[model samples]
Target: MSRLRPVVAAAFLGLWFLSLPALAQQEQMPPPTVGVVTLQPQSVPRILTLPGRAVAESEAAIRPRVTGLVTEILYEPGTALEIGAPMFRIDPTTYEANLKSAQAQVTSAQAALTQARTSFSRTERLLGSGTTQAQVDESRAALEQAEAALQSAEAALTLAQSELDWTTVTSPIAGMASVAAVSVGDLVTAGQADPLATVTQLDPIDVDMYEPSARMLALRDDIGDGRLQLNETLQATLTLETGETYAATGELVAPGFTVSTSTGAVDTRFRFDNPRRLILPGMFLRGQIDLGTTEAFLVTQNAATRSKIGQLTAWVVRDGKATQVELTDDGTWQNHWIVTDGLEPGDTLIVDNFAALSEGATVTTVPVTLDENGVVREQPAPEAAAETAPAAE
Candidate 1:
């Protein structure tokens, strides 16, 4: 009986140890080390991307008016030129000689005309006193012939001057000129070859893009209702083919006078500058035009999760437990929701533990770092650590 009592007593002590709260506390449990974030409202920039091409606001074709052998090319490719600068010389010596001969002919014609006039005057005076009628008629005919000869010579002299001027081809516009088609010493003819060079106006450049016709109507309505200002200086930025931002801002310009039926898009143009002249004409670029801005709740994508159906969602800690939210729209900015339907301001979301978390699990919250674009700046969780930690007994 005494032995039975010790056994019963030992069993009672074991049961008491198991029932104590301290024993429960001694059991190993999952750690609460997880990243968390709270939803917030802040102003964000709304952006849109469209394909565009850089175009010079103005351009001129450097062409000659008359046919000649290209004697010299003045401006090389990739050189800035001033207005009226001589770009090419087409053997001006020949044109100069022609001008001298035409001038000589004009002088000879003038001398002949003066002699004829003097002779005709003397004859008319004699006839008035008692000269024959045939002599009066002959004098008149000689005077008329001299005047016609003078007129012909004068016309030839004008032609020679024009031809001389055409010998030196000059730039019509001030800009960066490039020789696109020809070289020096080539025999160029009228309408045979294109311009020897092209001068593109680069100070004020144009960005041409197409927006849907419906958007145009909507924009017009917004402007009329004071939602948008038509003349407002909306900011524009450009991204080159390499995705680098251009160092210039553009101002919105007027739309094209016509719409394209085939494309259903209105041609939109913006004016900017190429201070460095790095932006070449007809190069494709990506642009972002600022629409109106608004405030929105944002959270980090690290705190986000996706369902089996590829839906994006987030785990938010509320009342000391992890709560899941299924985001209805796109989310990302400042590492959070740029646009969302499920999250509200002040809700705390977990950013670290994705695999170890369930819908109703509890976790400790921490401050999350996010950039201006709403990307999570926090260090990403290690997959190996997360995977191994779950297997710990």
Candidate 2:
């Protein structure tokens, strides 16, 4: 019995020793450490990001001005064209013949006019001698008729010249031309319904951006009157579909005051200089326009959550515990939420350790910083830490 008793005591003691480490761990364990950012209310620009579409500043459908068979395409397809630049050479054979005929008529009219003038001058000088008043008047009438015929012939010559010139089919505007719609030997008529090609002016491109009226309902309260300046409202930036930002800034060309009944949105147009041709017509783009600055607290996007109902809620550390609160967000500016209400100055906002946090959960905040990608680290980067550290004595 004594031998069994010693064995039991040793086994029990071993179990107790094994449990001691776990008890000590529980007793010494601290609360979950969280990364928090202190809220400092300041002036932030109210930026609105909206979807928009690109359009050419000016588009022209080029059709034939003269009727003839297309003989040669003078300009290359899909290339830049200047005003009065030849695009196509229509068959000018018939036009050339008409021009020659008109020239001959003008020459004949000139000869007839000279003869009539000579007769009229001789008759008027001899009116009191051999020539009677009626004869002189008849000569004057013939001279007037010749002059009229000459004027008519000259008018025909001018028209013939214009037609012959039009047979060259020159461009009327400077722009980029689309592919030729008609090929060689295609017979085109004057003022035809089908266009020969399309020219689009790309520089100073225009974009139509739609802003929903519902979004404007809160804008009146978000931005104050004095801050909304004419120049600031005209300024805009664009982001392409590939996630690359467009280099040039756009200017507002047209501001919308009326909302469309069907779309319930306001259409605003902005113009951008596109000398590089990076932005083409019919491209989808996203745009950001500054609605002026407002006094608000900027919260990192990582610290806030949006509900299915679109309510923005964030966790703020208060009284050493996490307090989940709803925030009034105007929008986003530079990857941060522009919070206008529901947060007080100097509030500690939990940006990291979200998974370990709950409503009223006790937490110990650690001084931390977020990287450009919003990843939280225990301390600021070395460069930032150096700048913030006190200077050496």
- Candidate with maximal TM-score: 2
RMSD of each: 11.0, 6.6
TM-score for all models, in order of appearance: 0.60, 0.76
- Model 1, range 95-200, lDDT digits (tens) per residue? 8899999999999999999999998899998985878879989988999999999999999999999999988888888898875577777888755557778898
Off by over 4 Å in 1: 1-34, 91-163, 183-185, 209-231, 241-243, 255-267, 305-312, 317-323, 326-337, 360-393
**Cα lDDT of model 2 by residue, 1-393, tens digit:** 878999999999999999999999988888888888788898887678989999998888888888999999988888998888888899999999999999999999999999999999999999989889999999999999999999999999999999999999877778899899999999999999999998888897998898999887656543445533323355889999999999999988988899999988898899999999989999999999876677789888998999999999999999999999999988787678888889999999899878998899889997677677666767766898799999999
Assess the local accuracy of residue 125 in candidate 2 as a C-alpha lDDT between 0 and 100. 98
Clashes of 2: 0
Error of 2 at 216 (Å): 3.8
User: How much is 233 displaced in model 2, in angstroms?
Assistant: 5.8
